[model samples]
Target: MKHLRYVPGLVARGAALAAALAAAGLPLVAAAQDLRGPLGAAPAAPAAPAGPRNMSESVAAVVNDEIISTYDLAQRMRLLIATSGVQPTQENLPQFQREALISLIDERLQLQELRRVEKERKINIVADEEDVDRQLGELAQQSNLRPEAFVTALRGQGINPDTLREQIRAEISWRRWIQGYYGSRLRIGEDQVTLVQQRLAAAASKPQYQVSEVFIDANRVGGMQAATAGAQQLVQQLQQGAPFPAVARQFSAAATAATGGDAGWVSPGEMPPEVDAALEQLRPGQLSAPIPVRDGVYIVYLRDKRGGAGGTLVNLKQAAVALPQGATPGDEAAARVKLEAIRTQATGCNDLEAVAGRAQGVVAGDLGEAEVSDLIPAFQEAANQLQVGQISQPVRSPAGLHVLAVCGKRAAGAAQLDREQIENRLYGQQLSMIARRAMRDLRNSATIETR
Candidate 1:
């Protein structure tokens, strides 16, 4: 139910790559002629060879039939360095160049796979003008440049404007391809939603314990023994009743150290496996033994515990009324009146659907039991103030006016999640892994030649 926004950097990368590919004369764009510079303006020439060619040099790697040129690799390195703001030092140039070349090769492979899938699936994926314009706008904003200024800057950097646009197009195309091929099949079922809701409800009701922890970064230390020894000393201090927060502030390497390593309120599953195991055996106000975490060790102390019925539940229904085609005063008033009538007839939560049905003009949706925070702010506020089984007045949100009903409530505390919720979470993780593997496979088989 959480709405996520697109990251600007991701959009920029896609756009930049599209531009680069377009410049390379790749068959990514259908209307290539439209992207060409002004008539009579000379095409930008490719950079000259930096060194003599060796005839006997073997192929670095082959992706299908395409060849990756050494020259292309060098250019990609320079561009990556310039874009990332990483200094192109003599000591780091070779390493950076190697990684950049690999990344380019992977990108090409993904593009090839996307094209193949699109053809086989007969998918029509188009990047609209608005999408491109938005990406361009974001990129320009980041660089404090106007669209025209950004294009000019690309030209100054030996990057053709068409090339950049093509790069963005390719990235968008690939994302669309992925969505078409796999997104629909990736689903979270009703049971999973219910389970998460229950788990959240339980977590809210459970006692919240304040704890201070010291985490020794084993990865930074020489070995596990060094980390263990550090943790042992910290535990000894805690046993002697030394203040945990002061110790943590002085020695903990984690970001939480700034807050004296205070982890606000941790539920059982929220803590690391080892830490959770240790805490399970300790009573409130108890100090845990050194707990091993990946590449580190932690010493935790239970500072205090607060108990309260914390969870809230809502039994709600929605009526989606379409706005009139044209926004006239009469149309608005009619819609408002219809919605108000539905609210007035609904005696309680049980009557919500009946009232909606009788209204005839409105469509009803059931949102069953939901957490307050899970609903939109306006809806959450309305639900919070209503008593169980109470019907609310019609409220206007962007989607339309919704008449909500609070059928029931549940107090917060820890509770076991249902199987459906567990499976859904697992499935989500599986889908992520699948996507990553697909990308990796494409990268491995791609043929790229860099200069």
Candidate 2:
């Protein structure tokens, strides 16, 4: 399953919902406030003291008449700390408690809905124990531990592993329920898919980014200030070596949250304007700071980037002589002499190894294969100038002096958009919009009290 991650620009929900969907890292998404509203104003229980405190079975809050026990809230806090790798401290404890409480309340609401649907509709979307175990095993695998060992680690941290299990259960059930309820009703016509394809083809000339994201929804977290603070806390944990995917799965509100926020290859203008701008400044492996836009805060990680329309792919071999950075004219002359001599004996790339081996202080081997435009400027010029199986005059670069051999060249095509993928993206987006509205309606109609 695609795990309910949303697509952007597929279905027309309200602008805010569309923007929220777009903000996440999904295949195709067109992709805040003070902390003084109900959630922020709702008093959270005091943070339990460090270490194992006495268990309290008293009510923490009531959601639609379903009780959220203080014990439940505490367990979830421990679970959040264990999974998110966020430190539980006096300063951050209240924040953690609030987040945990909200999570618990949401779960209660979801379970309530699931129960209502199953009873009234006679449809069982409830995830069985086996389903929970399967998810648990997958999560454990992500941590590079066996399920038993993963449970032990959580126990070691004084967290009840069952808390994590129950959370996973809710997630699975909710995902199933949403998909079942809305999947059939949403439709993507051939025309819609074609339109997306046309858009993708038109944008093929723009740079594309392989990105992953973590979106903190301001409304869900209480307000803009609260979301920002939470984002900063998450960022701190990320910088300290917490895994991005794991944290995203636990905390990000985007549909991509299920798949660790991998957006795949997104062209310019695909992401929200602020996110797109942030991506422009990010290099591969770099993580952006929390970017506040109209609807939420986004933290993007650029996995890679590539030029538009692709380029000529080439294979080559080289013979080179190393020179220090500050090499004098005399040193350059000497290195050139060595490479020129090697070039004569090396009739083609086939002779690169043996001919260069005969020269003193020379290094030679295949330079591998890569797109011409992706190469360094010096190499790009050399590859373009040289013919297949031909050797070039000595070239000077920052590395040293080199004689290049062009072994092969081929035109690489840009990635073409797929119709099925486009259709699926659109369908997923519609379902996501429906799910959001359904949840909102549920929250609005339900009687809820928080303490």
Candidate 3:
């Protein structure tokens, strides 16, 4: 029941490609326009192209006789910008492109590895298009739009949703391939789970950080100097309002980079003394200076923190009727009317979910379990008095009017959190380590050439 914010970073790495061109002072094939579509107003483009012809025909990088065409990189960048809200400005473009190229290289290596392993084992990686369709529909729903309208909106912005599809495919395929290739080996023993559970119990009442990281590996040829420079640029890019998740996707060597470098709710004691002290000095939404850690340098983003985390972990479901941006009096009135009808008709989570399904610009979702300290002070105070099966009066946020129903709540205890959560976290770290090593090995063994 962790209140985790999930921002899939696989496609965000695609934005890294344009970063390559920018770093080299090369212009993009086309100037990025005022893009307002599915995600938001995307950033501008990179350097202008060499000529009129499509860069798709031009080679960007070559891998084992395989080609990553310029067209691929350009389209990937556009889609990533459209989705992740990362802007590509002149100053940051080069750095972004450099990171993109690296991600692209890693992606190419992964695809190659997946295919080779598939062929050797006589296995197929099946990712149903239906799943993609479902995901697309769900994404469209988040914006309070229909699936086809969402695609049309993206098309209007010159962003192709297919690029997103391919990115999702790569993630799906890589996960399936890894699971198939290393099935039982990923499992944790009972003793290991118990130890993890014990640690959680001991650290349950300490200060915790919602941390994200961008890591630059010094193990490569140029050593610490080159790596430090990379970290410096990454920090600057982030400071300039680049989405941390996208940058992390493009640059982090750790497995968490796959999920935007999210190291969910780490207690202060869990962090190294240097990292812990660095975090202690910062407030939420601030970045740390590049910290040297063994073979690499890490730039951490402190997202949120808790001071002595003892509290109720409340789980609530909300049905919100969102007014359009720049809503007029009439729009607010209409939204209020709709919300009133919904509030009266919906008495439980299932009922509210139905109302959300039928109402446009409505959101029906579990707010995730959060410590009482984590909730906004006002909302926390209001929710504190409610028992299970109780609903709160409409709370006004800028987005719209929300009616929240307490789905469940409990005092923090070992039993409230299960073994699976701990196991998955452990397994994810293990998988990420293995994946990075596998990718490194593939790069070492492969004949890669850049154009």
Candidate 4:
């Protein structure tokens, strides 16, 4: 059954009634100052020291009338640290914990607002069984695990499957509410889309200059002065006709230093704003004076600029084979063999399904047509190598193994956008900003209790 899940404490009738009454300037049952005290101030120090023995039951703060347990906050912090791959130490753990707590408070607020909105609108958002099943299937496929294995993984993480499902359902319900309330009013006119297209085209047409640079690290001992000296010295060498790549390979600390810091052709938006600004003033073969970035100094020299707008129309085709959960190592081997057979027999996308079927696999999906750069590195390489109607060898990706065929190709040139497209893009930007503000306000007004 569809359920409307309310965040505890924030969803109570008394809380909602109190908020309405407060907004209407009614006298409070208790001192307004007492209730408002914690709203803007830093959290009070814990009554006792937080250590292993006391940590589980510690009260970090009270949100409205609810307590935020220290253990819950710690669990969230650990998850965040794991996902970000950051090592938590004594120096950083406190900061991380604080940030995690704030995030929890924000989430609670959002959930509360979702509940309030649902009540006001008299809507019951339910998660259909089919939707739940589909989601679980997808999750299993992603983890390369069977349903049972995936459930075990969740259990190992100390997560309850029912709680996780409830969270997902709540999120879905809130999204539906947002769409019903504001989706129609969100307008993206043609003019905005056209403007965006024009900008994209203009950017594409601009000459792309490849450059090599060296940044002297300033954070190490004697680093700032050494980098500064190195920048001046490198600039003099460039003026003396020393090769930029040679100097970059010898001195730059960046990853590209090995290749003489050869930053491939970059357009305006492709670089940091400061770098883009500097590049604008530089002509081909010109070198810049020392440019300072964070904790370093850079010596840059322009290598070459080439290419104007209009690139070729590359027709890219892909056949993906999605493996279902419970597929073992044997299943993976079978999938690969099947893909190879399809590749051997395929002439074009038209032959994909038949070939796949013969091999006991399926044409799981298509990526349709794509620009070369729009594809991932492996797919891009395969696509670029293929001739029209030629099928590629099966390649593995995170999504699955794919066989590509290039159906068509086009060369680069100048293109312009019509007016309608411009307006729509602009409208999208405006709507995004509006939505952010609305969500922020909703959060600020919510009586969130985190426990």
RMSD of each: 20.1, 8.8, 13.5, 20.4
* Top TM-score hit: 2
- All candidates' lDDT scores? 0.57, 0.70, 0.65, 0.53
Poorly placed runs, candidate 1 (over 4 Å):
1-9, 12-61, 126-134, 141-144, 157-163, 197-431, 443-451
lDDT of 3 at 374: 74
RMSD in angstroms between candidate 3 and the native structure over all alpha carbons? 13.5
Q: Pick the candidate with the highest lDDT.
A: 2
In model 4, the worst 10-residue window by lDDT is: 28-37
Q: Model 3, 202-281: lDDT tens per residue?
A: 87776667899877777532378878888887787677777787667756776667667777677655556778889889
What lDDT tens digits, residue by residue, belong to model 2 across residues 186-252?
6778787777788777877667889988888776777899889888887877888867776676677
Candidate 2 accuracy as TM-score: 0.77
Model 4 stretches with alpha carbons more than 4 Å out: 1-56, 64-66, 125-137, 158-170, 207-432, 447-451
Off by over 4 Å in 2: 1-58, 85-95, 128-157, 313-317, 323-331, 347-358, 364-378, 407-413
Q: Return whichever of 1 and 4 wins on TM-score.
A: 4
- Prediction 2 global C-alpha lDDT: 0.70
